[model samples]
Target: MNKNSKNLLRFAGIFGLIGAILGAHMAGSGSYAFRAVHAHILVVGWLTLFGWAVFYKIFQTTETVLTKLHVWSAIIGSIGLTVGMWLYMVKPFNLPEGVTLFIYIGGGVALLLSFLLFFLLTLFIKEKK
Candidate 1:
């Protein structure tokens, strides 16, 4: 497996564990406060990352600058978005509103960019003779 695939899979596993724990915590506490955060963690962090990892493992694409960008962006975006969501919604640390908003928006933009790059990557897949 490619290094990117391995890294993504690792990230996905971590996210999956986090999401599960959060879900369990919510259930036990009877509080749905972390609902959106948990959902995003599972979807964006676990499922999406896992899917991307699988893609990289199955398809032998030439690694380019775009590939690096996409990999890093996906990882960073996932962390930023999930953490930003928690900070924004929960405000556990009572952080400034502006900071939380910026993180949330920035993370979302990065994730969007990752998606776009992934689409372009698909278009340039090396055909197996």
Candidate 2:
């Protein structure tokens, strides 16, 4: 498979893993304390990346530097936001609240920047005809 296909499948796998964890947590705890984190993981980590992967594949975009940056930024943002929110909500790691909040927001910013980059790249592409 090509890189774009790999990226999509990888994100899809992430989605499955996150879904399993969320399911187990809900089953065990019967609480929605981590619901927001779970949602973000599915949305940004899985759906957004998957969408981008599909876009790249369909548009025949090469594995350029911008794509690399987008992949890295998305991975970092997705993991950071998910972990940060988990820490903020679960307190399992005993991190300071402020630190966790910072991570969450920082991840959000990175994700937004990635999206903007993707948009700019899209604008530059020509239809494959």
Candidate 3:
């Protein structure tokens, strides 16, 4: 597997574990407050990262600046979005609403860029004749 693939896979595993733990916590405590967080963690963090990892593994993509940008943005965005969501929704640490909202929106924008880069990447894939 490529280095990027390995890195993304590890991140995906971490996200998956966190999501499962959150899910279990909600189930045990019988509170659905973490529903949105848990769902995004699984879908955006785990599933999306896992899919990107598989793409890197299967496609012979060169590690260019674009690739690096996409990888880092995905990781940062996933963490940022989830943590921001928690801070914004749960209001832990008594953080300012503006700060939390900025983090959430910034993370979402980064994640959106990652998706756009990935689409451009697919267009550049070479035929394996």
Candidate 4:
């Protein structure tokens, strides 16, 4: 519908893809622990973030700093996740474990910043009710 809505859908799709991958692995009675990182990347990485973006769009959620924070954080975070996942999937390119973890930090940082902003903004922003 709009740029933000489109973004939400895009992110949500990515999340679904991750879930599907994890689901496939689990279908064979795989361990959840093994998929723990995938679960976070999907849930927090895609689902939660996308859902929040959608919610913000529908509600016209407003927070000057926080709003921007949400956008940039999610954007950067998703990008980081993509890089990390890519490295994980295609290791032939040659990468170090530290670098891989750093890439994941991008997503983690974004998620953290977004949530932190949400918390701060909710306090000052008037509730609809």
Q: Tell me the deviation in Å of residue 111 in model 2.
A: 0.7
Per-candidate total of colliding backbone pairs? 0, 0, 0, 0
- Report the C-alpha lDDT of model 2 over 1-129, residue by residue, as the tens digit: 558658766975787688678968887999887788778777877788788777776676677888788777877777787787788888988888899999888888888888888887887776555
Candidate with the larger lDDT of 3 and 4: 3
Candidate with the greatest lDDT versus the true structure: 1
Of candidate 3, the 10-residue stretch with the lowest lDDT total is 120-129
State the lDDT of candidate 1 residue by residue for 1-60, as single tens digits.
699999999999999999999999999999999999999999999999999999898888
Please give the ranking of all candidate structures by lDDT, highest first, separated by commas: 1, 3, 2, 4
TM-score of each: 0.96, 0.85, 0.96, 0.66
Backbone clash pairs for candidate 4 read none
Clashing pairs in 2: none
Q: lDDT (0-100) at residue 94 of candidate 4?
A: 83
Worst 10 residues of 4 by lDDT: 120-129
In terms of lDDT, model 3 sits at 0.93
Q: Each candidate's lDDT (Cα)?
A: 0.93, 0.78, 0.93, 0.66
Q: Kindly report which residue stretches of model 2 are placed more than 4 angstroms away from their true locations once superposed.
A: none
Better of 1 and 3 by lDDT: 1
Expressed as tens digits, the lDDT of each residue in 35-99 for candidate 4 is 65566667765777677666665664554756776666776776676567656555546888778
Q: Per-residue error at 21 for model 4, in Å? A: 2.7
